[model samples]
Target: MNLLDKFDAVTVEADFRITPEDKAFCEAHQAAYDAAIQSFHELAFFWEDMENTQKELLGSKEDTYLSSRDGPEISQRRINAHLEWLHRAVISNIVYHFNSTYHVSVRDDYVANNLLPQMPDLRIYENKEAREAYHKKLREAKIRYEDVFDQMLLLLDGRSFTEQAFHELAEKCHKAAWNLYQNKANYERKKALISFNGYFCSLHHYSWQDEWTLEDKTQDILRGVAHYETGSFDVYPLGFSELLGYQRSPNNEHEFSTCKKVKGLKMFKNGRVDIRFTSETYAAEFATRYLGLVC
Candidate 1:
């Protein structure tokens, strides 16, 4: 099953007892649901785009038309790289935000305000030990909700990716693209293309690129730290000289290095860092050491 199916199944299990409070919680968090729907629609649109690009590339037999300034093979490789990047971006958005954001919000909000308040009342159980067990069950349920919520938050924030879900999405996009491309029925092709383009147009009013901003200080620092830790970076800040002192030296002309060093600082090559804690600590430590250098 796809991520959405799995999400729905878990939700069904999680929704064993739905009260008026739950309904109110969902209503309060309608914006989150709207965001998720928008995200999913974008994901579907990009999936079609990726598939159509692949189909076009595959359908072409002549190398002359595909040739660029580099060569036909190089040009083709670039196109493939772009298509792959597009697929990854779409999958990232879906796995991170589209699939679970609203559900997580609803679950968390419901538990916090509704279910948690009833924890003290143990009519579900008789003795003290039984009451404790019931409380434990409630806590466990909350944790389950939080665990998935945090995981999705991490994914959406670009701290991690759901590998299995991503692969599944990629496969689905490829299959759909191929099927549509290979379809000989003109009417069917026209219908499918229209549907695909319609979804894309629906979201065309919003610029996805605006979601990533270099001017956002918090994002810039977090992205810089992520790059420093993992070598995987985004376009944020465009440079890291101010925050990380990363600059190229004229003497070397080919090598880049930091201008200053901070003590008690450790860096990693793999594993995700908690952006909230790491970014704050890194900034404070750097500022302290920077002042020490100046003094």
Candidate 2:
């Protein structure tokens, strides 16, 4: 049977199982895993210290820390100054650890590497109103974290890290290291698509608001019909032969040309893409090439 016909007849899920080699690779990077856990512990220590000091000075009063209305000006100054110094020390510690471990050279890199949960600024505490506003923002801001450090610190309730927490943190670190390996490996697998496969691949994920040059190029090259929805643009590469370069002869092309439909091609504003395929094989192929996988 024709491969495309088979694709048309079935659904496929990409096999993203961590192979033995991948597991071995993760094992090799045990140092990076250990370093990540240590980083989390250090941040948790700082957070606990901050929490204790804040409780001691404020005594359960929102209007007492640096509030001119509730405390003497000198008292407010002293408390604010001490808190500011502590905050700076904590930030400095985090910055130095990430720099040494991950070689994070810029502030944005911290966000990229999933290092810090909230990017706290001490300048927000420069005045009474500013301090109050900052506290309000913190109260309203959702507590969330991607890495173990942020997860533990944000959720810490002034208690010591228990053995279970340590075990859970270690488990999360293992998963994170494995995920990094998977992304690196899958990225390499898809790298061939840009070369011999005649697919245009971009590493930078474009925002919905940002100009996507690839959309224009896709229109110009494939001359495909583009349908724009409220949040996304779908391009049908009917003239895919010009871009795929495999339609010239069936002898030279893989099954991709046979199943040329780029149906339900969703560019998820992030650096990921998803396409609906009639055949599971095609779907798996497309998914392994484009979609982000988490393990």
Candidate 3:
């Protein structure tokens, strides 16, 4: 059968696929997909014009900031932003488009089913050397950002929309657009998670684990009881084999959701769980919930 036929087959088989709850989510995804395509066209045109202008200005030098090294620095920043935007938009579009087309769960159903490509760890972009190495790898493979755009167009055209087709195109576009940034890919994967291992150990009245100090600072989240950053820790309450979800206090009826101001919970094997709070208020709240103490 053709690609369109496969889609129709899936849709017919799952007649009860989209629920009433999915209406808003599906519409939101559609809106985002439309906006992302528009942004891609805008960025591509702007980048082309900027690249040409930079090339023309190469021989002209002056003491002014615009004519000095700042000019190139500013240009690089713009290019970097463009690349980052593309990377995010492409991934989002693929996920959203797949869900929208099939009327599937508008969440990360593609991700869970392995239909989308895995994103590179955001930390990889933080290192200049690593970025250059990745750029070289892309060059060796002869990949370009334009190829990613082409794949996007193909996917949008309804020519091939099966899961396998999406997977192939997503992998190609993800790699191409990611490599487009090179040394300038500085997208933050999550909130800033600083190491508080020292503080954690000190608070618990225990000695610090040397291994915790060596955890990669670039990772937005680290999982382990011993970590000082964004990961969760495993906590065993008295007579309980499982760790607490950190959802609520022993007596409270309400559950606390992990958010920007009150982030909590993760576990590394054979290590204690840890928590990171944005402010002293939340920190104290966490203390009261789990530790049975006020901060």
Candidate 4:
């Protein structure tokens, strides 16, 4: 039989696998696929721009506020590269942000100022000279950032000393931080899921296959899926296991049937899930029903 006929011979199971090249191809293509939907790599530049702008604005506040997320900058050729990097970035981000920004990156633990006068538990051992030199460098950074923040706040209408302004900005920071924490969790939760693997198995393009390990964020809904559906409906994702027909709570019934019929599953590296509705109601229903029936 010709190569096309070989498609029928393949079966979907653990026994089936692609070569490393095929895996790489799938990863590459899936990255491209993700990029087409979500501008993840663009975030690298976006974050860089943000960092630069913030730094320039808060030149002295660097030490007072840890504004940097520790990762080398990245640039992507297209959406594909962005998508590929997104998977790595989100997981890294979930870890980084929790330790760097919020205490709740992990369960139970949270970040907050403590009563101790001791510095953070960061330890470095080397020659006394090296330790001294490192401390000096860090001190300089703190001074510069503190001064920068002073200048920036002063520039923000000279309200740096005002209690109301402090309260407002503090509230904003807390809210933004909370939102960031939840978003990371949502990503982590979805990332733990396994669904697209079903599609991945079905769409095995071993000859042209690209291995993809995806952690999707729903900011970009899949095209041709119910995420963008219009007309009447509201959608809420109950859970990932729900897709395979697993129900963990009675709350699942309240999940609006708006665009699920053909909904695209968004996965994240951390463990959180939310929903995006579609523009078309019937198509959405069709997608949700079809997947339910098929699954």
Which predicted model would earn the best lDDT? 3
Q: Model 1, range 178-258, lDDT digits (tens) per residue?
A: 234443211111110111111111101134321111222222333333433333333222334432333212220111233
Candidate 3 TM-score to native: 0.26
Shift of residue 191 alpha carbon in model 3, Å: 50
Tens-digit lDDT string for candidate 4 (172-221) = 32222223433321111122121322111111124643222222222222
Q: Each prediction's TM-score against the native?
A: 0.16, 0.19, 0.26, 0.18
Q: Between candidates 1 and 3, name the one with more favorable lDDT.
A: 3
Candidates' C-alpha lDDT: 0.32, 0.34, 0.36, 0.31
Tens-digit lDDT string for candidate 3 (208-250): 4222221222111222112222222232222122222222122
lDDT of 2: 0.34
TM-score of 4: 0.18
Note the residue pairs that clash in candidate 2. 7-279, 11-280, 12-280
Model 1 stretches astray by more than 4 angstroms: 1-123, 126-129, 136-162, 168-195, 202-295
- The numbered model that scores best in TM-score is 3
lDDT of 4: 0.31
Model 4, residue 159: displacement in angstroms? 30
Worst 10 residues of 3 by lDDT: 197-206
Please list the Cα RMSD from the true structure of every candidate, rounded to 1 decimal place.
Answer: 28.4, 18.8, 19.3, 25.2
The Cα error of candidate 1 at residue 105, in Å, is 13
